[model samples]
Target: MHDHGSLPALGWSEFLTTWSLQPGWLLAVVILGAGYLTLRNAAGPASTVKGWRVASFLTGLGLMYVVVASAINGYAMALAWMHMVLHLTLIMVVPALLVLGHPLTVIAETGPRAERAMRSLPVTILVHPATGTLLYSLVIIGTHLSGFMDSMAQSTPLMVGEQVAYVVSGFLFLTGTIGEEKVRPDLPYLGRIALLVVGMVPDTIVGIVMLQTERDLYPVYSGARPEWALDAVRDIQTAGGLMWAGGDGGMMLLAIGLVIAVVSSPERRTKMTGRFLDGVRSARLAEESARGTTEGPAEPGSVDPDSDEALDAYNAMLARMNQQH
Candidate 1:
C-alpha cells in the first residue's frame, strides 16, 4: 500500500527540490572543510601545496554532504539503484578525489613531528596497500552479503555507520593506492593495479547476487517502497546491474589511468620494468641457492634494479637470450 503522505514521485523537479537539511552531515562537512582550509592556510607561503589539490579536497567534502543530504538519500529507501549510486560514490569517487587532495601530506607539512607521526609504524600499517585492499574487499562483501543492510533500515545509527564505513574503507584503500600520502610507502603501479582488480571481485559478486536472485533479499526496502517506486525485484536487479557495471567500469578507468601514468613517465616505466626484472632475478637466485652455488647474496644498500645501469644489464641479458634462442 502506497502511503499517500510519502514523498511524491521523484521527477527531475522533485529531485531538484527534495533535499533534506541532514544537519549532522552538513555540520560534519562544514567542520572538515573549515579544518582543511585552516590547515592549508597555516601551511604558509613556503608550503608546496597546489591549488587544485585544495580544491579537490573541498569538493570531496562538499560531495559527501550532497550524497547523504540530497534527494538521493531520501530516495534510497525506495530505490535500490540510488543506494548503489550512493555506495559507489562513497567508496570510489569521493575517496579518490579526497586522496588526490593529499590531506595527510598537508598535515605532515605542518611540522617535522607531524611528518614523523604520519610515517609512524601504526599509521604505515593502517595505510598499507595490502591492508587497505583487504579491508575494502571485506567491507564491500560483508555489508552487502550479511544482514547489515536490512538491519540498517530499522536503525538510524546503523545507517550512519554504513555510510561511514563506505567512506573510511574507500579513503584507506585509495590512500594506499593513489595519493602521495605520507602515512605509507608508495605502492608500485603494478601493485596498485592488482589492488584495484582484487577490490572488484566483491563488487562483482555482490552485484551478481543481487541481479540474479529471484528472491526478494531486502524486505525492509520492499515494504517501505512507495507505490511509485520500482517493484522490489526490479529495484534490486537495477541496483545489482549498477553495482556490477559501475564498480568494474570505474576501477577499469582507474587502472587505465595508472597504465597511462606508467607509460608516460620515464621513472614509472623504468620502475615497472625493474620490478619485473627483480622478480626474475630473485627466482634465478633462489634456484642457484637451491643448487648450492657459491654466489653470495646482494649487499645491503644495493643500487635499485630500476636504475639505468640495471635496465641496460637486464636488456643485454634479454638480448643474449634472444640470440641463443
Candidate 2:
C-alpha cells in the first residue's frame, strides 16, 4: 500500500507501480487487448466492423484502469467519497461504453461456433432483461448494506469481488435494456426509456438516504484518513452527493442518447405511425360496439378530406390512385 502521507502529492510512478501489483488490472488489460486483436485479425473483405467499435472497447479498458489501478483507487480505500466515484464509474460509465461497443455482436460475427455459443440456452437466460435487472438491483442493495461494506473494506479479496460484481451487474443491466446484443427481443425505444427511468428510482433513494443519515455508514475510512484531510462524516456525505448527482447525471445522458436514437431511426418512426393508426382504429371500433351501431362503408370513390380520421386513413390512398392513373 502507498503511504498515506504522500497521498496529497502522489506521483505517476507510485500510481503505476501500485496498480501493476493488482492482478485484476493486468488480467483486464490482457483480455481486452486479446479480444480486440482477435476481432481485427478475423475481419474479412465483407466485414462491416468499423474502427469506432475497437476504440470504444479500448476506452472501456482505460476506464477500468482508472477505477482500479490509478491514484483514484488508492484514495478510494481511504475516503468514502472517492469510493463512491469508483463505484459510479464501474457501474455506470464503464459498462455503458462496453455495451455501446457491441462486444457480443462482434464475437458472434467472428465465426459460426461463437454465434452458436452466444445463442445457447444458458447464455439466453443470463442475458434476459429480468435476470439482468434483478442482479443489478441485488448488487446495488447488497454492497451498501452496513456489514457488507465494512467487511469488503477489511478484506482485499472481498473488495475485489465487490468491484467485479459492479462491472458484471452494470454490463448485464445495459445489455438487457439498451444494448445491441440480441439477448431476447429488442426493446423499443419507448421501452428502453421507461426501463431507464424506473431504474433511477433505487439509486436516487439510496443517495437520498445516504445524504440524510447522520452517522458514518462505513467505518473503515475513519481509521485511514487521506492526506487531503476529509473527515469521516463529511466523506460519507460527499459520497452520497456523488451517488445522487453523478448516478442520475449518467442516467440522464443515456436517456438523451436513446431519444436521439429513436428520433433518427426511420423504422421506429414508421412503427410509431402504424401503432398510432391501430390505436385510433381500435378506439373507433370499441365506441361503435358500445353504441350498438355499425357505420356504413364510405362511397367507393369519395374521401371526407376535411375529417382528420378520414385523412389519416386515406392519405396513402391518394398515392396509390396516382400510381394507378
The most accurate candidate by TM-score is 1
Cα shift from native, residue 87, model 1 (Å): 0.7
- Models 1 onward score TM values of 0.86, 0.79
Off by over 4 Å in 1: 1-5, 273-322
Model 2 agreement with the true structure over 61-85: per-residue lDDT tens digits:
7788777877677777777777888
Local distance difference test, each candidate: 0.81, 0.72
Instruction: Encode model 1's per-residue lDDT on 1-325: one tens digit a residue.
Output: 2222287988999888878899998888898888878877888986677999999998998899898888878787778888899999999999998888888888888888988988899988888887788889998888887877778877788888989999999999988767766556666777788888988898999999999988888876467778888888898999999999999999999889889888998867655534556577645534433333365544422535545645655666677689999
- Please state the error at residue 150 of candidate 2 in Å: 0.6
With a 3 Å backbone cut-off (N, CA, C), the pairs that clash in candidate 1 are none
